[model samples]
Target: MRIELQNTFVELRGEQNPVASAVLDALRSNGATVGAVAPVPDILIVSLPLLPVAGYDPATQLQSAMATGEAMFARGSGRVLFLVSAAAGMPMRRHAEFSVAMAGVLATVRTMAMQLGPKVLVNALGVGAIGEKVVAGDAAMLGHASVKRPGTVAEVADTALFFCDPLNSYTTGQMLSVDGGWSAGYGRNF
Candidate 1:
């Protein structure tokens, strides 16, 4: 099936972050045709980073990604997989801010998926403590993840592939956390 891969916040032409690059490469090498600005396709994979920068805004970034995905869906794209990585499940520096921002994005995606009908599916991959130094530091502050070891690139890539595949028809508006059981242990009442 054809795919439209959107790399939001891509500054360097043809250069991308490791995870994004890996996902694109894996999809292409596995025989999926990749298009940038397209006649649209069967899927759109959005890989955007979550961080606080002076002029770079996460909300706008998310909106742009969502808009592009919506446009693709309007043009007959089947699914959109939003791949977002936050430092230890925190979208921003503050927990509450992160929660609000994440919720907004999720709600928008879910609503769009519903409005667009069964042809369009929206999914998110929430990664936690994936060996990045910033994530590692955050994980330490939150105590160790239940898995202890950081997740690998292969692991994340595999999950992305699963969502991108046709076999994943039943899942949508879902946040599949590759967070190593981190979300479960948070604020556990002992």
Candidate 2:
């Protein structure tokens, strides 16, 4: 059962969303040979939903996404790139709902990775604050990001490429934070 899970939901508050566009371009440029299931391409990209810090829901969404990934893993074939965000690690100003939600999703990924074995590598792409118009209003919160500058679409795409590369066989069940250096600093102001 070869599955190509495409995430079409765009976040209302996201600064930039080149992921889907880049993915489409990748498919077009790479041609139709990209979706092979038998040998299964070296990578499988799973774009999960993005929730805001306020009114959005994360629990149900995360659970559903995790279940989808788990089911894919059960089929057994290629590597899975779980696209999460640095927002998952953001400070909870109003509520800790997002944190709790991502925790559950991360847990599911880890557990599934352990049970699946080496053939199926599960990893996550943690996006840092990117300069997008949607997040312009929240500059204060994003100021703490290590680079202090927003990330580019190319940077994110590059990281995704690295994870999906056949040469990256040794890494698995890991959460790669591409958030400049925000995740490292302690008192903020990196």
The TM-score leader among the candidates is 1
> What lDDT is obtained when candidate 1 is compared to the true structure?
0.58
RMSD of candidate 2 to the true fold?
A: 6.6
Instruction: Give candidates' CA RMSD values in order.
Output: 5.5, 6.6
The alpha-carbon deviation from the true structure for residue 96 of candidate 2, after best TM-score superposition, in angstroms, is: 1.9
Candidate 1 residue 72 C-alpha distance from true site, Å: 3.5
Shift of residue 11 alpha carbon in model 2, Å: 20
Q: Write the per-residue lDDT of candidate 1 for residues 67-123, one digit (tens) a residue.
A: 666676666647777766443244434444454555565666677677665767788
Question: Candidates' TM-scores?
Answer: 0.73, 0.69
What is the lDDT of every predicted structure here? 0.58, 0.53
Query: How do the residues 19-123 of candidate 2 rate in per-residue lDDT, one tens digit apiece?
Result: 534543443343323433333343456554433454445455545444545555666555666666555555434335655555555665676578655657778
List residue ranges in candidate 2 displaced over 4 A: 1-16, 23-42, 51-76, 89-91, 134-138, 188-190
- For residue 116, model 2's alpha carbon misses the true position, in angstroms, by 1.0
